[model samples]
Each structure stands twice: as C-alpha cells, then as structure tokens.
Target chain A: MKLRPSSLFLGLAFLICGCTEVTQIGTSVGVASGTITQGQAQSIKRSAAAVEKTFQDITPEQEYYIGRSVAATILTTYKPFDQEAATRYVNLIGQTLGQASGRPETFGGYHFAIMDTDEINAFAAPGGLILISRGLLRCCRNEDALAAVLAHEVSHVERQHGLKAIKAGRLTNAALVVGTEVAKNLTTQELAEATKAFEGTINDIFSTLVNSGYSRSTEFEADATAVNTLRRVGYNPEGLVDMLQEMQKRLKPGSHGFGSTHPAPKDRIDAVRKILGKPVSIVDQPVRKQRFAAALSKI
Target chain B: MMRKWLVVLGLLLVPSAVALAVNARMIVQVQRGQIRATPSYLASVLATVPYGVSVEILQTKGEWMQVKSLQGQVGWMHKSALTTKAVPMSSGSTTAKTGATSDELALAGKGFNSDIEREFKAKNKNLNFAAVDRMERIKISPAEMQVFLQTGAVKPLEGGVQ
Candidate 1:
C-alpha cells in the first residue's frame, strides 16, 4: 500500500509524515512498535534516506543564501552578543565543539552566538547556526549545562527538523516568526486565549511550529541523541542529566516556561537516568565549573 | 622589416581593442528553493566567485550578468550554471552570451540601487553607431539599461539579436 500521510500512528507520523507508500519489510526495530506497521516503518526509512540524499550535496552558496536570509531577520529580532570578546570567544568555542563533534564540515561551518537578551532560549536553525539567549546561559550552573543546550540544538540540526518543516510547508516563511513576537497586534481577546494556550507545559514557540507541540517521545529521542553526542565528543554525557535535574528543581507544577517549548524537566531527567542505568553515576569529565565561571564572569 | 611589421600589427590590434563598447553584470536568483548549483536539479546561488556573500538579485537573471558584491569582489558570473553557458575559459569573452554582437564589449559593471533607469537613457542616446563612442566610459550594458529604453516609441533595430 502507498503510505498515506493520513496513516501516521501518532509520534511516528510527526517524524515521517504519511506521504509515501511502503511495502512490508517483514521485521521491525524495537522503536517501530505498534505505532508503525511494517509497511509504515519501511516508508519511514525510505523517507529518511531520501531526505539525506536531498541534503547531502547542498552547495556552499545555497547554504550562504539560507544563512544570509535568516541570519539577517534573526539578528534584527534577537540581540547579538554585546561583548565582542565573548562573541569571538563563543564562536571559537563553537568551532572547537564542532570539530570535536562528528560532523565537522557541515554545509557551512557552525557558528555559536549569544543572543543579547535575557530569554532562556537556545535554538538551532537549518545551517549549523546556534543562538543561546543570555537568560539561558545565566541559568546554567556550569559549562556542562551549556553543553547540554548546545548538544540539544545540535540534535535538532542533525535531524534536519527545519528542512522537514519547510518541505511540509509548515513554515511558509519568516513571517510566521515575526507574527509570534508581535502580541500587541493581536486583539485583547485573542491575546487572552493565546496566553491560556501557552500557559504551563506547552511552549508557545514550539506549539506554533506544528499545530501540536513536539511530543514527549521526540524529546526523549533528542535527549538520548544529546547524551550520545556529548559522550562521543569526550564531554561527560551526564552533564545533560545534571542540567535536566537542575531545571527540574525550578519547574513548578504549572511553570510552562521551558516545558512549553522543551519537555517536562523532571520527566526528562528520569528518562536520562533510565538511559544511564549503571554504577557510573558521574561523568569522568564533569562540567569544568571554574573555567566556565571565569569565562562567563563578564556576561 | 620584421620589427616594422610588429609595430604595424600592434597598431592595428590596439584600435580594435579600444573600439566603442560598454559593460554589465549578472546576479542569479535562487530567490526560491534556497538556490543551489546543480547541473541537473537544484538552482545554484551565484556567489561573486571570490568571497561568497548572500546576495538577492534586484532583477531576475540578466544576460550581461556582472555579479557585484558589497565587499567589492566584482567579476563576470559565467552562466556556466547550465550546459549552454559552458564555454572554454579562453573561448571569446565570458560575458558574451549567445547571440551577442562582436562589437559589443560585455560590461563587468554593476549599477547600484537606482542606476538602472539612468543606464537605459544612456544606452538609448547612443544607439546610433556614431554616438556610441561618447557613451563608452559610462559603460552600462544594454541589458542592464533595457527596460528604461524600451518604449513603444522606439522602433526595433532591424535584423539583430533581441
């Protein structure tokens, strides 16, 4: 049967839209479960393979175009690093992290930047561009927490979420972003409803990405990917676990703050613990707290 | 006698080289689909060849095709994007797209912001072969200047490339 996007069984549907036909491949990976029929699972793999092929040969010039168009809009909306020293230092650090990470020569090189504002946000755009809001950096107890944020953002890029959104026409243009920021333009009644929708666990920005906010399971997948990424790079994988625990302490019953966009912190922490079930509780290289403190002292 | 012939030959070549001509640049529009360079599938973003800056072409693909950069890495963007634009590097002028006149000197110049309208006025004033010599230094090619000169009043020059 031709895989129809309408056949998606929840979370798997979100990952691979039911757009193609799949012939059954007989067996299933544990991840496929009841959510995916064998044919659906085959379609998902084919779709992922096709997407990889489509992205593999993008030119440096095309990368520049997407980077240029989005970078300008994002820069205009978000404050860039105010301190030149910190900006350059963070970029250098990002370069180092990128080299340490497996995919060194991405379409264009990866650039790290600190957004000038105090919003606890970090996002990765399609072309290896990472932006961490000052507020998020402030919340991190150490460099490892910062690494967790960076690693999470990296997973988003590696998974090509933005391109998929574009392919699906979920994002028509930057207008969707600009529209989100200008709440005053919304009628008072409209604003009230939006606030209600955004309150507590649902992240407004992510909720707006797709009609449904990213599922809890996708968050788990990303967290799993993040730990593996940090471990492969020789950074302590447990830093993500620690960061999740820290965020969990701050998350009140109804604090939608990060959860609205990210997963529930305590739930994620539990998930991480489950993944790391072993005698090894600490990462050999825990966050170098002193160096991180010294580096971020001025920010 | 050989030295005399060399001087005479040099004298002949110099005049033809200096013959009246103008120039222009081409900026590609991957304005859609995040333009990429592919002989087959995706549209390739035309960078200035030296230092790549993300540029949006003000006009759709122009034939004269002078790709200018804000950083000033100015050069001719060869239509080398397709099989048709593929020419041996040394074969004739790179800017001369097919059906270009031999007398036409392809311009590797960009008309910044609002220069397009003025360039057309310049081209129209010199359409007469005799007046073309005076218009040489301003150097905006006919393509960059075309729309402005195109009015119903001006009749087509009989028997030439459009």
Candidate 2:
C-alpha cells in the first residue's frame, strides 16, 4: 500500500488542532480499532496540502529567507555604504514611514541600507530589506524628499510587490514538492529540486527588481501608498513630486539606473500630481533641511 | 466496542471544535519582535520573543494578538509576526505527521533557509552573504525612532491605526 504524505499531514494538522494529548489518543484509538478507514484518512490529508499552494500561503519565515537571498544577490552588485551615520538616518526615516504603512511589522522587521554607488535607484527586497543608492540620495532636495523615496520603497514591501513577481507555475511546483513530507528531512533529490525552485523564485524577484522593473500599475500603486504614508507621517506629500522633478532633470535617456528600471519621470510626476491636485508649493522646513544636509555631508 | 467508538468520535471532534477558541498556541515566525503593552506599535514593549518560540493566544483585536509567553509575560504582538504553523527549531528529526505543518518544517533550516543558502552560496560564489548579514544587523530601537521623528518634527497622528 502506498502511504501518501498528504494523508499523514492531515493527521498532523488534526493532532495540532485537537488538544494535543486528546488528539493523539483519538488518532491512536481510531487507527488501532480500524474505526477510520485508510481512504477517509488519506482524503483528509490531501486537503491539508492544498492550503499551501499560493504566494499568500508562503510563511513569514519563508519570505524572510527569500528576502535574505534577494538582498544578498543585490549587494553583490552594489557595495554597502560604509558611513554608519548616513545609514542610520535613512533607517530612521524608513522605519517611521513603515510604521504608518499598512504593514507596520514584517517577519524580519524593516531594515534600510544605502548602497555606495552613483546609480540612481532603490530596491525593496521581500520582507522589508530596502536598499537605496547614494545617487538617489543626492537627488532628494530635502529630508521630506528622502522620506518620499523610502516611503515608496516601504510601500512596495508592504504590498508584497517583490513576492508577486514569482511566477505562479513555479510557486505551485514548489508547493507540491515541498508540501509533501516537508515535515521530515528531504531526500537528496528532493532537496536539489527544492533548491532549484528557490533559485527560480529568487531570480523572478531579482529580475523584476533590476531588469524589468515593476509593472506601471505596480509603480503607481506604490506612489499612491507613499503619498498616503507621507500625509499620515506629517511629511509633505509634495516631496514625492519634488523628488520626481529632480530626477527628471538628472535622468538621461537610456541611463543605466532608474532611467532604465522605472517608468519615465514625467509620467510618474503626472500620476502623483493628480493625487496632489495640481502642483502645490512645497514649504521649506529648515530643521529638516539642516539634518538632511548633515546626513549627506559624507556622501 | 460502541462506547469505545463514541469516545473516538468525541476525541476526533475536539480539535475542530476548539481550533478557533482561546488558548491556541502560535509560533513566533519573525526573527525578533516585541510584545507591546497595547495593540499599537508605539505602545510600551512588555517583552521580546525570538523565532520559533510558542506563545499562547489569549485574545485578538484587529491585526494585534494578545499572547502569553512561556515566561508568563503577557503582551500584544502584530499578527504578521506570528504563525499558526509549527516552526521547527532544529533539523535531523524525522518525526513525521506529529502535527507539524509543511511550512513549519520548511523553515526548520531544511527548506529555503541557511542550509539551502549555504548550498546556493557555494554554487554562486559571487553573491555576498556578508553584506546581507551587515544589512540585517542594522536595527533602530523604538526610543531612537521616536527621537528621530521628534527631531525632524515628523509627528504621526495620535491614536492613528499604525
């Protein structure tokens, strides 16, 4: 008789769901007396495996693991900025905006780092590992503008745009291989297959982050969320437009970084302007500007 | 035989009946998170829990769950930080069907974890795990976060849904 892994998982779910001790007694008694037929037990187990077929079903710990790899892959291209103070300042701004975002807390918590590069771009890996570039920082005219950038990245993480990049067929295949008997150590062959799936998942996200960029709709959603976050955090919502305008002047056609990875700045500016209702004057906050300048000094 | 079957039936039904009730133990899936005094991120932290630690759920309000740690400390944690699935702390144990979820087992350093990352890193030697570790090490405490916000005059709404 072929023992199905899903059937065993069904019993496991039952065991955890029942008062652990009582469920153990029940399962043992049912099996010993043959009161529950093998077919019924197998059917029960099959349904348990179905629960893990989607990206939404990917556990928080799983997302963290994927995020760690994605961040590692990104770091290979851009060295981390060695300035501690600058990194801390960006983290503070990112964390504050994250708190106001829909998902204030993620599995690994929100972490912000600066890549020591002249490339004007940012990447939000899954599970809140956000990396921004020094070139992008230089484009921010003030602290509010910086918050706008970080908030946009935080929105991407909050909405799980990175995970969405994973192809559906890949996730389904992974779920099948891993969900079956994942409760035990995988055999050598299974481990290889699971690792391959992991690599594919990572590549899907990395490619979207670096090569293709998020779909235009996804970028717009992040912008809209960032605007709301800025308002809730008491930063000027117009800072986003200001940042975009600055990028418009600096971004060269066919440039490598944001110029290649993102939608045209003019289009993004127009989208944000609709939300802000015609270009509004941005009030200068000196304290914010002074602190921003202080943080940027080493760069 | 009839009485034995009745008991078996009752035992089988117990899990489904109590699954939604209070006292369900949940695992902490996040690397580390604080249990706050209130159901808000800005609330005073009552305790901290590391990954794979199980906490007893006492109540839930919106996205916040009030949980009691093994140390007997009671506090609130965001739902995103907790998982209903069992989290395996170690590997090499093949005790199957003991109610451990597949996702739980996957996270036990066997699936898409440090073990797999080690394999991946070996294959792709160009990737930088060291920088990833440095990125993970960057942390900001709640007090420091509050101070930073105050310095910049970025005041979040009072009692706003965080």
Candidate 3:
C-alpha cells in the first residue's frame, strides 16, 4: 500500500474535498494529513462555526462605523474643545504614541479629540477614535505623562475592548440580517432589524465606558500595556506611575468620571510598579518638558 | 486498477490546484491602506489600495507583509489590513453575485455598515456626527510626525514595525 508523495498529496486533497461544508476543509486537511486528531478536528469545526456570528466576526470597516456612532454619542455629552493649537499638540503626541502601539493603524485610522468637560476620564472607542477630557489632560505633569495617558487609551483601542462589551445575543441578531445566504442589498425589514441591533450594540459599549467601568483586570492590563508603549516610544516608563500618583491626589472617591470608570489610582500604580520590577528613574528632558508647557499652558 | 486510480487522481488535481492558488491570495480588508516602500510605517507610500483588492504576498518582516498587486506594484503593508479570506464587494443595495462562497458573501458589507448608520442617524437626530467627521479629518502627516518625534527626542520603537 506504499504510495508516492504525489499520490499521498492527492489522497489528502481527496479527503479535504470530501468535506461537504467549505468551512470544514481546514479540519479535514489536518485530519487527512495526520496532523490533528479527529476529536480536535471536530472541536476546531465547532469553534469556527461558533465564531461566525460573534464579535470576532465584526469587520474593521464595521468597527469603524460603530466607533463613529460611539464618538458622536460622546460628543453629545461633552463638547469638543475648540482650541486649535492645543488640539494639534495633543494629536501629535497621541499619533506618536499610536505609532508605538502594536496595532498602530486601524481601518478608519487613529483620531484624537479633546472634550470640553473637565471630567478626569478618556474614552477609546473601537477603530481608534480617542476622546480625552480636559480634566484628564490637566492631570498630566509633563509631556511624558501625557504620553502615558494617551498610551493607556490607545491600548484600549488596540485590544478592541469596546467591542467586547457587545452582548453575544445582539451580535448574533445583527449577523442574522446579513447572514451567509443574503449578500445582496438588504430588504427594508432587514435594514430595520440591523438598525435596532446597531443601537443596542452602541448602548452596550457606551454603558460600560461611561457609567459602569471595565473589570479591574482590564484596567490593570491597560496600565501594564501603557508602560510598554511609553518605554517603546522613548519616554520614561515611570511617567505612568507619576501620572497615577498625581491622579491619587485629584480623584475624589465614589465620584463620577474616572472615579466611576476606572480603578483606584493607588492600585493602578502598584500594579504598574510590579511590572517595572525596579524603579524607573525619570530622566530630565528639557525639550519634552518645555513643549509640554507651551502646548498645554493655556488650557 | 492502477490506471483507474491514476485517472481519479488526475481528475482531482485540476480543481485542487486551482483551490490552492486561490488560497494563496491575500485580500485587502481595510477601507484604504498605503503600500509603503519599506516595512516601516515611516516609509514612503508606494500605492494606496482599496478594500476587496487582492494581492500576492512576496515576503514578510516583523508585523509587515510585502505584497505585489495585480497591477504589478510591489510594496509592504501592515498585516492588520489584510486577510486570507475572500472579500465580496457589493455596489450599494445590489445583490453581489460574483461567485463568492458563503463565508465570503457573509463577510460582505453587512451588519453595522453605512446604511445602518444612516438609518440610526435618521431615528436619533441629537448625536453630533459633525464633530466625529471633524475628528476623523485631523490627520498628522508622516512628515509632521517625523519632525515631532525628532524635536521631542522620541525614539522609534526598537526592532518593531512602526
């Protein structure tokens, strides 16, 4: 029963093509090639089918659209700051840090805006629309610390944390309107259903970002990731610790904004310190400090 | 018996070869992305590719993939902007019948697209989409970013694609 290598490849292809469902080809290929057990193949197929209509299936373009709506909703609550020079300065810092973030570019590209409100919070909508409040901006002591804040927010976008808030059932419902069988223009009824689903999706993320905060672990993870971004972008990693130390003094316990949406500053500082192992001495950068003052002096 | 099996194998080879070739193609999933002259984000833009265009992967470096477009333009693109799966494009409201498989069809501009956004906006008039549009337009050119980094003494990421 010995066969040539070409015959073996053909045998494997035969087994793969035998799969009735196109999605099962990968599993079948693995099985035919003796790479994966039958049980593993079944599990892989199940997981693949399960992922079809889930949040993971959301396309980058769709994420961009959802982010637009989310940013718009936030803008309704907090007016965008109208200072051109400051806005440009913050954007420069934000963009520079974004380049250091592992996921630098999004489908819609990264955009930064400052909110007029003095709430000590920042929002990173899916697809890279970041909204930082004036209150939060004022907390930064220097350009490095500002980089730390923007880096943290950018981490949220990079990890698609906003998309995680969408209810599983809502995603399934949304996928139904544009299911595999229907690729053509949606019927009016389908359009209506999709609109409803989109509304629910936005509300899910909005509530998590504003009223109810992310889990303590998610916040800790962002702080940890932000340190890496700061270090990678040539800023002092201790800048995150410095910003949190300052925040400890300003944030009121049981209050709204960052107090409501983030973990305590002390806890975040401790978590970041554990990752740092040794204290990262803040270096004196006259250039960074001077620009930080000039850009944010009026705000 | 050997001849009969050989015929069967030959019959399977044609379709299988086609399938293998198709699987090698990478599709651009982003709305628009620049193909750069090098793997770094700071490299000059060689060409801008739109969604649903297919490219052939030539090589890879760090988080970047070098690809050649159908028009014979070669450049590097970030891996995030591409997918191995086929992307079916629909011309607004018309059914796409370009022989796409079920998975490809499902991935077409479906859920949470512009149409749904338009519908949602029509129903809720209070949201400030104008601000969002303005925010999206505030882009920092690569040259500006270069100067900002140099002036501020910010170093590029070490050994990582920026």
Candidate 4:
C-alpha cells in the first residue's frame, strides 16, 4: 500500500502537536505504505523531539527550583534584614501587590524579603522570590510608594524577565538534551551533563541581575506594568513616580545597586509620568501613611 | 488488507479531530482567580475558578478571554490566568483519555528541576540556601491581607470604604 499525501500531511500535523504516539504510528504507517521515505520519518521524529525549545517551556516546578537557587546566590551577597516587624510589613505589602499582578500564582508562590543592604535595589527572581533593599524601603513615603516598588518587581517576575535574560542558545541546547528525560531517573552521565546546563542557566541569570542590567526597554516596560498593577490594586500609580523622584535625589550616576542596574532615575520618572497621564484620582488614605511610618520606624 | 486501510484512515482522522477539539478548551492555570463580568479587573466577579478547571474559550479581547465555565456561566478572564491545553474532561478519571501526550510530560519534566538544583548545590557550596528557606517561610495570611487592604482602602474587599 502506498502512503497518501493527505496521510503524510496529517502525520506532520500530529508531530507538530507533539503527540508522540500518534506521530510514531503515523511515521510507521507512512513507512510501511512507502508514502514517506525512512529519512523523512527520522527527520520528523527529530523535529518532534525539538518541541520544547523555548523559555516558555520551563515548567513551574523547574522555575521554582531555579528561583530557589538564584535567591540563595543573591543572599550570599546581601544579608536578610534582621528587623522582624519591618520584614513582615514588606512581605505583606509585597504579597498583596503580587496577588493583584497578572501572573499571581507561581509554583512556590510569591515570597518577598527585605535585604539588609541600603543599596537602593530590588530583585525579582523567577518563581516569585522578590528582594528589596532596606535603602530602597527608606525611599517610600507611604504604603502606596512601597506597593509601587513591589508591583514593579512583581511585573518583572510576571514578565519572566529573569528567565528571558538567559542566553537562548544555552536554553535550547539544554532543552534538546534534557528533553523529557527529567521524568525518569537519570544515569550518572546524564546527570552530569544536566548539571553543567544548570550551572550555565544560573550564571546567565546571575550576571544579568548583578552585572549586566536588563535592557532599557525592558526597564521601561516594568515601570509601565508597575503603574498598571498599582492602579489595579487600588493604590495610587503616582507613588511609582514619587519613589523614582526620591531615588533621583539620593542616587548619583555611579552609585551602587539600583542606580547602576537601572536606567537613570530621571528617565524612569519621565516614562512613568507619561504612563500615568494628567493626575487622575488616587485613593490615598491617611491611615495608609500612618501604617507605613509605624512599620518603618525601626529602620 | 481491510485492517491496513482502517489503520491508515484512523491515523489521518484522529489527529486532526483531536487538534480541533483541543484548541477550544482552556484550563485555569492560576491557583484561584475570578471570572469577572467584564474584561477589566475592576469588573465584578461572576464566578471564582480554581486551577485546572476547564473553560471553553468563547472570544478574546486583548489580554482577556471570554470563557464559559462547566456550569455554563460566561465571564471574562485574563489570558494569563488560563492555559490553552485541554485538561481531562473527567476530573477524577485518571486513565489516558486526557489527550495529554508523553511528549508533553517529557517537556514538562525537562529543565532545571529539584534534582538539578541538588547537583548544583553540591558543586557550589557557598550558595546560601538558608536565607532562601527563611524568606520562603515568611508568609502573610489571608486575614492579615484583608485587614491591610481594609485599613489601606484598597479595592475588591467586600466592605471597607471602597
């Protein structure tokens, strides 16, 4: 029996959908019918195997693990803030903002910590581990400002910017080699290769976070998302602009952490102003200010 | 000879049918989210959906999707809240009728998972897992969040100066 051209097309469609059994059956049938050559069948299988090539393919579990390691690495550089009340306050506000963000539920859920450093920086690791520097906290005048900062970091995690920073070639290579093998127990050799890939993945994220900052456009996008998230959560979007203005006063061009990692504070403020547009109404309660001050009094 | 022709016909028809069916179904990916009366977050919540509950996609407007729940309730949900994959229609039946493929399982399994993290930790001893663990332990309860929202006058709370 000869394979029909329609059958070959159907087989290709199944292969593209990553339906492994259907693809195998299709290929086998194609081969038996002489509709597809042996080489064609082999190539189809190879392409089917290449299905999980992008960063989007990283499962929630895998992202959680990556985030844990990245958080660990970050902690090696900055100590956790020892002030218990302040830490709790930040976590509450951060988590609230997270709940209102576009991508709310991650694998391990969103966790926010206040790093003891006064470097004026924030980091959002993949899988929802967020870190804010104590100095950055000092810049917030009210709960709205604090929520704005956390919202910005949440936007980064939501957008998967940290994961996007990973070199595509590295992820592609790892995905190709590690494809589906993660479900089964690995042999020692396979484990070693995957470990190498894992190391590469960590370094890629680390360098992007610590040394080379995200692109200017990416920073702008986070700022825009921050305003939107803040508004959605019923906080004033102007709080982001206020926070950026405060940072502009305290941070010089060559200062460490945020000053160096992000676009100029003035540039950010301008961008945020454009986003907010014409001083709309804000729900700024005096109670929020009092609570924010009480929480940060120890700091 | 009859069997061979039937096999050929099945292969050609099954995949296309499955593909068409799969595209119409979407599963809620978030732990919990609301199907709102409209696309905006400010819109009233019509129904709350938990993770893995399949909804049929009715329409799309920008980032929001109009979906029909199993109960026939129609509302808008954010595109980010749902996964396009067709979940097993029967919630409890664990047999292979879910239309999920082993290739997908393999794809999901592939990446920097727990095992890889263990190996990475062994190689890099200086990495501080303790701090990460401590951070994870700090959680805000729902009651705490509600009080915070109420005091701050944040929206979506049932009663508190919205």
Residue-level lDDT of model 1, residues A17-79, one tens digit each, is 443222222124323455556676656654443343233223323332343333333444565
Order the candidate numbers by TM-score, best to worst: 3, 2, 4, 1
Q: Residue B71 CA error for candidate 1 (Å)?
A: 28
Better of 2 and 4 by TM-score: 2
Best-performing candidate as measured by lDDT: 3
Q: Score the docking of each candidate (DockQ).
A: 0.01, 0.35, 0.38, 0.27
Query: Which regions of candidate 3 fall more than 4 Å away from where they truly are?
Result: A1-52, A180-183, B1-23, B90-108, B156-162
Better of 1 and 3 by TM-score: 3
Interface-residue RMSD per candidate?
Answer: 26.0, 2.6, 2.4, 4.6
Model 3 lDDT tens row, A1-299: 86755456656766776533544666666688787799998776655554567677787878888999999999999999978888898899888777668886687788899999867989999999999989888889988888899999999988889999888778755766544333467889878888988999999999999989798999988888888887777777788888888888888888788998898999898899899888867765788788888888877
True contacts reproduced, candidate 4? 0.56
- Highest DockQ model number: 3
lDDT per residue for candidate 4 within A81-112, as digits (tens), equals: 86778888888888877766887657666888
**Which regions of candidate 2 deviate over 4 angstroms?**
A1-52, A180-182, A278-280, B1-25, B86-110, B157-162
lDDT of 3 at B34: 69
Question: Considering only N, C-alpha and C atoms within 3 Å, which residue pairs clash in candidate 2?
Answer: A12-B99, A18-B15
